[model samples]
Target: MKRTIFQSIREYKKQSILAPVFVVLEVLMEVLIPLQMAKIIDVGMAGDGNLPYIIKMGIILVVMAMLALIFGAVAGRLAAQAGAGFAKNLRHDIFYKIQDFSFHNIDHFSTSGLVTRMTTDITNVQMAYMMTIRLMARAPIMIILSLIMTLTINAQIALILLITIPILGGILIFIAKKAHPHFIKVFDEYDVLNNSVQENVNASRVVKAYVREDYEIEKFHGISKVVFNLFTKAEKIVAWNSPVMQFTMYAVVLLMVLIGGKSIIFQTMETGELTSVIVYALQILMSLMMVSFVFVMIMIAEASADRIKEVLNEVPEMQNQPNAQKTVKNGDIDFDHVDFSYAGEGGNLSLKDVNLHIKSGQTIGIIGGTGSAKSTLVQLVPRLYDVTKGSVKVGGVDVREYDLEALRDQVSMVLQKNVLFTGTIYDNIRWGDENASNEEVQRVCKLAQADGFVQEFPRGYQTKIVQGGNNVSGGQKQRLCIARALLKKPKILILDDSTSAVDTKTDALIRKAFREEIPNTTKIIIAQRISSIEDADQIIVMDDGKINGIGTSEELLKTNEIYREVYLSQVKGGEDDEK
Candidate 1:
């Protein structure tokens, strides 16, 4: 875990090194000042009231104080820079890794869990890094230097302080071991809590429509209570640190006074030396306490570090082959004994042994029940996932043998669950072609039947869409998504139930527009309605994980029982509704 995180400290290596260097200098200066103070107390004030000697020592002490202050300030700035920069790079690395993920990779991780890792986990690591460079580096050096000075003054008092070290170290280690697991559980609970919030906000309309606000609040309370209980347990263990430190502190001080006082009275130890030893005692014990605090922080951040490493260590399931084809010459698709699974090998296959060939410029329709893997089949065309067995070929070349970006650019798919970011309607549509002119943008919208509704809005194409496009109707949202795909002008366009909410007339018009305006583009429509695909060149019916039948709509109705039944049911339902 340490190795994984340290690699992200690429450009910040200089700042990381400088932070500790300045911390050592600051601690050295601080240790020397106490010795000067002891001289002023025992020698200058007591013996001959040596005014000139005291003035000289005092001036030296002031200069050391200023130097320590400057060193501390510089160390603080460097630590902040290194910590924040490390986190910034880690976040960028994690997000870019996520972008490279295949469908199989995303299947194993939850959206909310990834969000928590990128945010809360990274923040924990950042805090730990800052403390490591400052307190972790400074405390040990200060303790060792102070102890050396104390031993020189008098070894007996130094021995008394030294015994306290192991006992405190043992207790702190025990506390850390007990608290570490609880900290890990705390962030896991945070993932659940964040999931709850994301679910509620995204579905607020549905919650309001069903009058389930009170239920949502109760559900939120349940998760929040779990998180609170977890943090309470972790903190209770950590809270033992303070009293342990305080007790050891007073115990060492009392022992120093009792032993050193007798030595001073017997004239074996000078008053100035005894005073300096007392100062060193405080320095040594406080250094131990600081170390304990740093240990606690590392213990907490260990869990976070592991979580971050999970993301950083993940290798994307699919990668482009060496010297892969960069251009997709055509949209022809062939499924040659293809198989797929969300799990990689020896896992249940979601799609099985499917064979279908689509010529360039042909129109195909895919109809299937939920979980029959309609979306899974279409996703393969763009290399969103690699086949578990056999091959999926585009332009007579295996998709795995093409550059990922080049493959995806040739295929445009509007997913089942689409999203519109917070931006003007024109801006969202321009996502497909950022440099698209106003004329080109309007043309796709017109073909999607979205231009009419968009113009109805006071701001037309410039109207701002709220997050998720909640301001628009479901049908309107679907049309806008289609317009975005149309702007891609891809050779192959897959609409995965994209026009479900639109009226039958509007759906027919969109299909008509596709035929007239983009005749050479291969179009695949996945729909529930039989009427949506009746005019297709070929239609496929899927059952379970296999292709049930594939033929033109007219041929399927005459020979395939599944197609015959569906067509009659829909035709009868339309007639009955006319009554």
Candidate 2:
């Protein structure tokens, strides 16, 4: 346990050593002050009382106490500063590591588990480090120093003190070991409770729409109940330690008084000496009690440290290779006999034998049924999840060979679910291009058909958006996301059913703006609506992760049954509009 504690402290090397060194000095002052009081009483007040000597010892005690207080304060400040700094660095490291995790690694821990590790788990370790340095380090020093002083005063009474120390130590050690596993259980349940609450909060709208409020409340209560039970068990184990230590101290003090009285009567110890021995005995027991308290803290910290280590030790699935080369061109994409599956199961492919190529100035549309793997196929282009088989090349180079950042920068995707941060309209739009001028942002907003509503807001471009853009309509949020993506002027732009919420008129305006303003960029539009992709230069029809047909809309309508069926079902008045 001591080695583990020291190893943990080494993470804050200089601060840890300095804080404890000051604390040990303060403990020395504490032990010396009591001895000085015994001297002032026994020697200064003995025979013809030495007034000058008593005054000198009194002054010395006061000065020592003052110094101890100053050192205590300094140690406390240093411990807190060190604890906070360690926690800050730990959180930053964990957060940055989490960012490097690919979809596979992230899914293993879940969102709320990672959040719990970053906040609650780190806090436990920080509190432990602070308390260990501020209080625990002094416990042993004070106990040992007080015992030495007690033994020097009288060995007989100190013998009784020796017996109680082992008994109390044994009890504390037992309780600490018993409570350690429970503390771990408590934190695990805490993760479950956090996950439950977070899930309900993020999906509150869906819960309300389904009218499952009571059901959700029941589920939350169930999770909270488990956490409460675990906490109660841990508290019970910890609560037992204090009373048991106090009992042991009381027993030792009673025995010491009896033995010291015998010594006084036998003339083997003076009255003042007896007084000093008893005081030192009490100090020893009190210091042991403080040490026991530190032991309990150790148990809790051990549990939390294990939790923190779990996150810190996690190996991220996606990391840059040593000195990987980056792609150099603007926008050219090719999928060569690509096969992929979310399951990564043997011989199971989400996309199979797929080959496609798009040049820098081409517009392509992708259409498929609900389970046709349309989104998965495009996601591979951005390397969100790498393909299980074959190669996806961007700019005539394999994407895996390109620097991750450089590859992602060349492609911009507006997913079906548009996510918005809590910020002003201008700030959200600027996410695409951090250094974009106000005119550039405004231009994209106009292009995405978002300028009119944005201008009408009370603060116009500066209007604040709630998280998820909850304050705005769905169409408005989609348009804003589109504007953000457009602002990047990406080499390859992907719209994965992003314009579904907007009315046809707005959609047409956005399409017109895209054609006129950014005709040189390669575009991939994945849509379920026939009208949405009817005018593309090429349309690919997908079925069961395989490309079933690829041709212009007119050619597909005449020759492809699947494409014709989709067109007939969506076109109002059917065959007449199709013709």
Top candidate on TM-score is 1
Misplaced by over 4 Å in model 2 are: 1-12, 345-348, 572-579
| Per-prediction CA RMSD (Å) | 1.4, 2.6
Model 1 regions more than 4 Å off: none
Model 2 score (lDDT): 0.83
Taking all chains together, the TM-score of candidate 1 against the true structure is 0.97
For candidate 1, the per-residue lDDT at 518 reads 91
Q: Lowest lDDT 10-mer window, candidate 1?
A: 158-167
Q: Count the backbone clashes (under 3 Å) in each candidate.
A: 0, 0
lDDT of 2 by residue, 1-579 (tens): 234323444457778778998999898898888788878877999899999999999999999999999999889888988888777877877787778877777777867778887888788778887888877788878878888888888887777777778877788888878877877888788888888898888788999999999999999899888888877887898788878867876777788778878887898777777777777777777777777777777778777777667666778755667776666486788999999977775857889989988887688899999989899889998788888889998888888877788777778899988999999999999999999999999999999999999999989999999877879999999999999999888888999999899988888888888788889888899988787788888999999999989999999999889999988777855567768
Query: Which candidate number maximizes lDDT?
Result: 1
lDDT tens string, model 1, 180-291?
8889899989999999999999999899999999999999999999999989998999999989988988888888888889998998887787778888888888888888
